[model samples]
Target: MTTRTLGRLRRTDFPYYAAHPDVVYLDSGATSQRPETVISAEADFVRADYAAVHRGSSVATGEATWAFEAARERVGAFVGAGERELVWTAGATDAINMIALGISDASQGLGSAELALSAGDEIVVTEAEHHANLIPWQRLAARTGAVLRHVAVDADGLWSLDEMRGAVSSRTRLIAFPHVSNVTGQIAPVTDVVGVAAEVGALTVLDACQSVPHMPVDVSALGVDFAAFSAHKMLGPTGIGALYGRAELLDVLPPARTGGSMITTVTMDEAEFLPAPNRFEAGTQPVSQAIGFGAAADYLASLGMSDVRSHEEGIAQALVETVTRTPGVRLIGPAPGAERAAIASVIVDGVHAHDVGQFLDDRGVTIRTGHHCAQPLHRALGVPATVRASASVYTDIDDVSRFGEALGEVRDYFGVTT
Candidate 1:
């Protein structure tokens, strides 16, 4: 299927693709290309309304605060969260770390006991998790004496609901996993995982970096305790992401970061902090980046998430077909007919992934190579690395076709014919 048939966005909408019309960008899983509106939103804010938010009583401060809070509301509503439920951070990695460190504080008696971990308690994760989601939990487990347990993946690098169910038990305190795998393009059984976690009274933390930018995600509807996603993965600016927590949980999650702006009153001996978001946001906020994120959300909403999903469905099919049809290529994710995100990771029979990447780069086909920050998953897959191609709203059929053609020529270019 073609992107034209599925109704995709024009490349002209994005400044990067507009400037490099000959380049076929397929790296959206890492970071997306921003639309002109999102860029203008940030630039315009910097030029006209830039000021320190949540401080001082000047008119400039008031306008800045209003814009900042308005952006929060826009982003929250986009993901089915209330205004207070979303907390801004540096990125998804920072958001996950905040949650982990906050829970660590809880275990140390800094906050409410609802999320506190203790010796012998289990923190469940999957083998397919991104390092951002996995390593934080590992550190938390070490700090609290909790055991870090994981659901192992199959030969295809995909974890099943049964595996997830088997991993959680009466001692499970939290379950951390991705909504979609960055390496395998596998869509996780989130609802099933959430159900299993609920059965064991475990909190669910979703790494939504891959899912939110590609499909419709409702953290509340999904029944997760927390979710982490980056604005850059969804066509917004970098250095700004969101942590979606249940309002009650955020209010008591024990701020991992504390400074000016987060507290209402501070004494030499102790301090009293504000509620939810303010408790999490310390120091000066990312005001202009937040506005750009809100603009990206609005742009996607206007384009219709359903339409975006439909378009990516076509892209996924094309990607799978391309990999399956090419000789000497092994796809790392779901089978050709199975449902997946618009991502394809593959290993050429003889050429290294980096070599494949270089060959494609020479053809103006940009892609991600190496472990892709999934060393454990690559070890499990029995390969050192794989080249990954991902799509976004701006990607089209021609871009994918170019990728397929370049990929087909790789083995021959390296003189690897058997």
Candidate 2:
């Protein structure tokens, strides 16, 4: 199999593909296999520089803190954010919750007036959002008495900017949505949506989990107030992710989780917190994982997202054409020739998605099957689950061809004539 369009990924760089010669892994949507550089970065840091960050003043602590902040800078640069804009969290779930919970704190009059969410205000989201983005806002609205509204998706699990305009209003306080859909791979109109939020004086929160790793995403360019993504999705460690906020906004917003490292002064009753990132990062930080994720971001920057995007575009096109050309295989999301990410979720006519996934797995073509944490979108599409095959920089034409040919044989293998 040929490397489709990029140069930074030699199969040797990724230990998983190098070790397993026969497997065609197509599940990059769930998590990408870590490269040797990212893996080695983590191991090297743990071996050489493992120490508690932002606590002690010892030499070892200094080095560890330096590495941690260096990672923050590297990752910030990768996402077009300033050093002060990032706050590391457990993952995207935690990152989004950080913003939601902090806003909830505002609703309680515990934070600055910028974040205050009163009873009459509203929050806007899209129907194509993952549960990670959807549920938190639902909780946010419930907690603050704010109205929660969603831009509906069409039959293919896609929504348009015009539809989004209809959903937003002058009373909107926050607009939470995804940059790219995890299930359908539809890229959102970030600039336009941000403009929409701006006109209404609403804040924008982006679920960048599906966008950050696969493409070159600039938080500044997108004009989003806050964006969240995970390290695991970007070929780094699993337990770490980041929340990027506008420096000014984060400065005034209260920390969601409070404790030692995040606070400046603690009295017997009240504790005054730090600013921005320091305020948000509560306890001991994810030091080694942050280093690894920085290395991962460095790796992607080295490859250049342009090459990666080119590689995936070809794969996306092939996947769309392949699935749609086969009978009883309904391609979900934007049709071929549309601006989509490297993801294809399909509903096979006669077989369940789980069975389709297992059938492909037996043939050594690994794919993800389920609601993909997007049950609302699936419900909109009139399906319970879908077989989702997503591509990454390492995915090649041979892997693409294999999945298509195998998918064509699924109906016959299951012995269904309908």
Candidate 3:
């Protein structure tokens, strides 16, 4: 929680910062740097015990399966989900797609009636959602004859709880939104939205990709029907993520993917699928990646999420202060001193975001540029692109200072005058 503890966290746990001592990494919103424990966990598993899980009754298979399932338990518990409620997918994008595709199947009378979307049913999303959350529901609405509506954002790229409530109506079937905006770093009022969804008998799906890593998130506590997040963003390996659904809902929702491991019995004519998590996990699983994901969860748990949140809060404040003090730099999302995630996306008045990124890169400061996969959000904000500097548990005051110093020079370096 102190500066000393933050220093120890970065130096002792993360090797990426040590290796690139001069480079300031401020892109943890896109993907986090892994701890040594996570890297070792994956390598150690592959080196000592590598086998196809649940494919056979061999000792190797059993051991591999145990490790894989145990990883699932860790991740589920980390998110306040029962083990049965978590389904592994390729990543958060894939997880959202799975839910959309499964709902599409349900609309076609393939799964439980409760999840079925009939003609004229409405699906609501926010204007600030990342494409992963937006596009999937767009496809689902198109496929199911459901109407898609969105809660609009203001000039600052934020939507209010009242705006969200206004978007929902009697015909609303589902409400899908992000826990935090990937572009603007605005934290959505999740509990308020969940309450609104419940009032209308609408299902809630949360894109927790940005929130789960930076703060404490309990899917059950939030009362969302389903939530998705990726491991890579949370200091774990790529190619793995989790979809959390209520037990009863997951039990009935059809698996979007069908293959070998997820089956209970296969016939020439039909197949009976396993329940919940297993039914959703088809084909060969990401066994080693799951182990690494579990290790990442353990590492964060050891630090305590409360402390992690506290550390990032300070970083967020520093980032806001830095951006606000710099002339010709427009800070997106919440204003100075407002609560937000540890991400700062800004637009330099005269320079393109890519040019700003290049300027920073030249100064050994790393940041994300362009629309950051939320083109609609950028479009709404009336900008083509913006540069984003995000922080993680490993990011310190010096990192933010380096970013600030580099950013303050961006206009001068480009010969752009206010």
Selected candidate, larger lDDT, 2 vs 3 = 3
Score each candidate by Cα lDDT.
0.92, 0.90, 0.92
Backbone collision count in every prediction?
A: 0, 0, 0
* Higher-TM-score candidate of 2 and 3: 3
**Model 2 poorest 10 in a row by lDDT:** 1-10
User: lDDT value for candidate 3?
Assistant: 0.92
Q: Which candidate number maximizes lDDT?
A: 1
lDDT of 1 by residue, 1-418 (tens): 3476543445668889668979989999999999999999999999999999999999999999999999999989999997699999999999999999999999999988998999999999989988999999999999999999998988989998998888889999999999999999999888888899989899999999999988999889999999999999999999999999999899889999999999999999999999989999999999999999999999888877878888899889999999899999999989989999999999999999999999999999999998888888988999999999999988888888999999999999999996
TM-scores, each model vs. reference: 0.98, 0.98, 0.99
Candidate 3, run of 10 with poorest lDDT: 3-12
